[model samples]
Target chain A: MTKRITKEFADLQTEPPEDMKVDLITENDLFKWVVTINGPKDTPYAGGLFLVHVILPNEYPFKPPVINWKTKIYHPNVTNDGKGTMCLGFLRDGEWKPSSRMAAALEYVRQLMIEPVPDDAVDPAIAEEYKNNRKQFFKTAKQWTTTYAKP
Target chain B: MAYTEEELAQYERLSNDYVPDAEGPLVSPRQSSQRITSEYAQADPVYVHKTTTLPQQFSQYRTVKGDGNCGWRALAFGYFEALLQTADPSRVLGEVARLTSLNNVLDSVGYPRDIYEDFTDETLQLLKSTAATLPVHDDGAALLASFNDSGICNAIIMHFRLVTSAWMKTHADSYVHYTENQSIQDYCSTHIEPHAVEIDNLGLQACIDAIIKPAGIAVQVLYLDRSPGEEVNQLNWPAGPSTLNAPYNGLSTIRLLYRPGHYDILYKHEDIDILPAAAVTNPQINLMSGPVYLSSSNVCYSQQGLDIDNFYIPGLMSAGVSLAYSTDAYISNAIYAPSALPITSAATDPYSVPYSEPPKAIVESPTLEGPWNTDRFRPSQYQVEVKFRQVMPVRPEPCQTEAMKQAGESKAHFRNEDFQPQIWEPGAEYNVGRNSEPNRRRSS
Candidate 1:
């Protein structure tokens, strides 16, 4: 809807996808988008494509956007109950300034696909599972993505 | 964040002022001075550079020249050289390089001015005599168990800059205040205890910082308590926030402590039987002992104190018969001191450990925060400007017996006669001191 989001969407559309697809779930609303990201190369998550929903706020540039995996994802920050609330690590609660943007937040989630910050994470169960049983998390994430997001 | 063009230029100007010229004097005050310079005195120029001269050979002799604290430098070099002689051959070169640079502040000019004074020949002899037996190296732990003998073993983790940094961060508040206030006594009494705690807590990070970030030299943190165990405890061992995650030098720390009878520091090495004073072969305390103001012969002496005595006049000395005229320049120059270095001497890097060349500044490039914290490294920058200055002294009113009674120390009573020694006789005319009294006067 805004100039910055429009520009970001235009850029994402132009980039070629190796293992992921990013586009708006609802064609009329640009703020709610779907991103199907593949697991990083060589990681236990190899060949796994994970789908997530990204929700942009009304106060777009000032506040950070929220991204939740619609297709059951196992991560320290993401809850199993499907409540999309995730704490963005970069923004210190009392210390976060008004200048942080949405694009940066999205890019961090994209990076989370490759490496997970378990030390500074919130949900220990998922983090533990991700740590102790990496093969299982990759199998689950990939199966959910394939079953729920391929269309 | 970006700077405006004007702000950027201002930064450039400030940075440009810091680059030292190669041909300048070997010693000079690193900072500016204004009122401390009197019309009668002038400052000599000084220079700084790397020296190949081994410290052991120079232990017996000391150079009388330089601008700031020369005595401390001599002592630092003396002890370091002694350590090299006793230590394993592999540890010699690195320890020599480290100790030499650690005492860089002393090389700036005439420093530790208090010890430079012409005390009794006995004091001078004591200083020179004790040079041989002085312990110079603090015992260090081997970070890599297999690489024990090389100086780099424990030193790899014993980053002096970081240790100083931890000391500074832990005690920055008090040190800044005392040093800023120019009161060494205050620094000693008020700041030392808590300062020790800061070092204990942040030792690891401080060492890492010293080893890696060369430009940011660590502060010299001296501990009052001398037990290596106590020093280790005071250093707070595995310095914080990320302590458990990282293994620094095998077990993660080397402890420091003090040795008795001598006023120096010691460290315990794993194989060595004895720990000795390794850093300062001779520690000097610059203060007035008696009448003749003792200071380094080469350095300018700044005197301060109000001259209450109007002019050269007659006796407040004795209640005797028929006294004629007498002359004296009754001034208490003892209480005052000139700014030895710049008034602010601590700001310059307090200590510098040598690396072959200054480390190249790393450009900050954004990288995703990694899963684990990592320690960064940089080369040494020997260039430092001293800004630490002695605090002005405070003189309380002479507490008479009556005044002493009002306060709590009532047990040690004194009569008016006992208070006679405390009176301020305000003229130089009374040249004959109490010590030079005649036999009959003494008997009475």
Candidate 2:
């Protein structure tokens, strides 16, 4: 329900996660959220600012929110298309629980940037490149981050 | 490489319309038997076998709405139903106190007190009012009405879910092993705490341990899955010790019907005398006998606990099958005709095995006046009187030795001493460890 979402939004606002900022794009709609995550150091995305668009369903917590990468990134788990979709196992329809909050989802995305799971990757080509050619994978990822995800 | 459009469509249809047959009442009137053959007429061999055998063990069941919250709703309904059977205001008050105290567990588990307090308060208020009104109006109808109210019911059930989740979180070390290596917090957040999340075995166990066991109520979960068995597997949530080794003679127990993903309530015909008001008002027409069909659903108002004498013979005779009566001693006995019939009577098939001793005498005041008389129906040839035993409230003294007593005393002491709050220490090392775990896949 929106009540739980409002509580979660308030909780996140009071004590936002480290290096992450959350904002409502419109004053009327609490369902749509704009989240900004600071890429963890030591990853190819280090120093990059990735923006994520989160759209909560009417059945908010029961169904998982729809999340898309607004910023372009070259990651094994994230698609490099216009949608820039991220494949989070927990965010999948059957796997999502009402108790899982937007904060946890965002944190999971940050973790994915740090260590991409090549095994269950959305982008098959990127996954293959990451698994077989680590150097080239890191170079392209860093280049994409520098070009598209610059703060 | 991926699922075809047809496959995706099929999956969507299955997900959306899976429980079409689950549109019954939250708790339906008891049926004569489980209606096994009719219910599972379309089911496969495994379900059919289990369903057929279930009625042999359990006489009646109440269907619950197969909404996502069926598991919790079923358990809550069972808890209240069992509580009403006790008819003791003190027991209801005890539940209030027990539920109130669980807030401490929630507090320790880092659940914001303000967030969960209202839910708990709602539950406590409902219990208090129910207990307060017991002297004037104490019946299953009141309990059912309370449960049917979505606002009250949802609040109480949610409180229970939180309590179970908090209990699991508090006792994470014990439950973590059962989660296939998922951390306690993660496990609770995803499975136990969520609203509308169907309870798995571990979650069910946690609830039994936290709520039902402590409240001194036992529950038997009849598993009617596609398991190969003539008899359904029953898991008892024992009232004492909460261990497999403990003896299981609990004061009260309610039966739960468990299909693959849903749970509904089951009632023993002999245990509770008063049936739901709806069933009592509109008795289903029994085709075999003009007398009220003694199917599990027929609410016979008898104070003397289900009088086997009053059990209708024509119905059983018409079924033309010897029903297995699973008593404590004569579990192997293939048949038991509740009515007194000649050994050679059509009701008593050749396979009807007589018990060495009569069934245990159930102590209840014989109040209901019925049309059938034991004197008129008594067959001179065979007189094997079977009495269904009611679970006595007395605790077993033999099991409580000095060591066990000391252990029980120290358990309370250890609870305070060993209780550790699960606090996530936000430190650099913790972050590093989390980021570096390549092989550690998060459980979805």
Candidate 3:
């Protein structure tokens, strides 16, 4: 594989867009991706988008496969099936060894879409609307990205 | 408090007679059958391997205000020597020897710790919302009963230095003069009635609210003000005396360990005093001394999985993922101690359909009438048509093995009796006749 998708696409191009994001939804399946995040703009999802769907595991770079999120955005750190079932802190329990790469879970899910962490939400009602109605939870996540994403 | 059927069969025979391997069932060999893995070595195989085992029992409450002497064991030994000097002098000296043996069994059951300036602003927002729900491995009596169950009594370590500092300032007449002039029990008998009480109250906000209630972590206490050269205040840092003459030895001296939203780069490129006389960036005179608490717990053990990276140094990789749970519990107590066991075991299903169950029909064959039947009960179909005519072009001995080389072709190696429709009619009759030709030329 272009050596683990070119080092998680050169560490999603040297991290720091407040944290992470290794683009490429097309360029012929370096292993089916989509990415697009924003949220964590200081939270209550300051800008909110969060797309997600990376994939890659047919034994790529060996072992760790499964990164979800096809967009149905809400979190307790993800996992209520709008996909990107987010769970880092070591790509989640089994604690993902094999020196955990995917360019550090693509900069730990882009610093978890800029910290959508209400501790680690698996969706406690979007971690209690990002901990109690953060500006009408960013106006219902900008009206769920103009009604069901993919624009 | 449930477990009984002979204590869930002696905790399922001590959670299935030890299985962790990579040198862990506590130094292996308790008559080891190589620990377990012959498809989960039988008799009770439902998932569980390492076991975390919580509940060291809690429920012993007391938060009596001043004079009853509240220094929650010297403010939980000076907030675990300032959170073990911001991390990793050997994992904050083993969480400061597990919060100093659970604050010496709650200071021989006296329990009342120090500095509880009464409290209100809804008990200082329920002690900074239950110390932002503690739990990255809590034990110190559930972080002192989650700060005496939120209404916060004996304000242990001045309610975590007024909830990890930034000094809650919304002054609309100081939030109605500290909420209609103090009533969190007369504001802790009027401003912690002159400091000095029994401090060190162990129970780090109930181990950070059981690591934020099942990792649903929602900690958000933000305050920012008193700008200029960006706030590094630990009350003008520099204070070390007792606890073996403090200083790096008794830990807790850190002042500005950045990298969590880079605290607006020490308040936007440093420079303070934001009106009405403010101060706070004075860690022994403005910045520069580094290492005053910057241990973001190694980006929280890669968010707790442990592939390890980013330890600007706070308990370097959570003290190497908590001393890989006592050096190699097959990589952190067999993967973060059965997912930090609260009770998960339903046989660890997680989703349940992994190769569900339907596959036992291997080789039944009851209606076979022609592909070389040897006139009836298959005398091994004439040695499988002379071993498919001596392996026609010669390929399939499982494509020459190295464990089937890479597993392709699970079937079709040779079935082409010209695709099978001529049924041997032209050959059945002629074969019955030539069969006598000395067993077809003595099997060719």
Enumerate the candidates' DockQ scores in order: 0.02, 0.09, 0.01
Which residue segments of model 1 deviate by more than 4 Å? A16-20, A91-103, A132-151, B1-444
**Which tens-of-lDDT digit does each residue in B356-402 have in candidate 3?**
22222111212212221122111121222232233223222222112
> Candidate 2 or 3, higher DockQ?
2
Comparing 2 and 3 by lDDT, which wins? 2
Cα RMSD (Å) per model?
27.0, 25.4, 35.6
Task: Give me the displacement of residue B368 in model 2, in angstroms.
Answer: 38
For residue B232, model 1's alpha carbon misses the true position, in angstroms, by: 43
Estimate the overall C-alpha local distance difference test score of candidate 3: 0.33
Clashing pairs in 2: B30-B297, B31-B297, B32-B295, B32-B296
TM-score of each: 0.24, 0.58, 0.18
**Model 1: per-residue lDDT, tens digit, A1-151?**
2555676676667762455567998998888888877766765455556677877765443334667777565566565666644554543221222223344456677676568776545566557677898888767666654555454
* Residue range with the least summed lDDT across 10 consecutive positions in model 3 chain A: A92-101
Report how far off residue B203 is in candidate 3 (Å). 23
lDDT of 1 by residue, B225-300 (tens): 2232311113332322211121112211222221111112222231122222111111111121222221111112
Interface RMSD values, listed in order for every candidate: 25.9, 5.6, 23.0
| Candidate 2 segments whose C-alpha is farther than 4 A from its true place | A38-43, A46-49, A79-82, A87-89, A93-101, A146-151, B1-34, B42-60, B64-70, B84-90, B114-158, B168-198, B225-230, B238-252, B270-272, B275-444
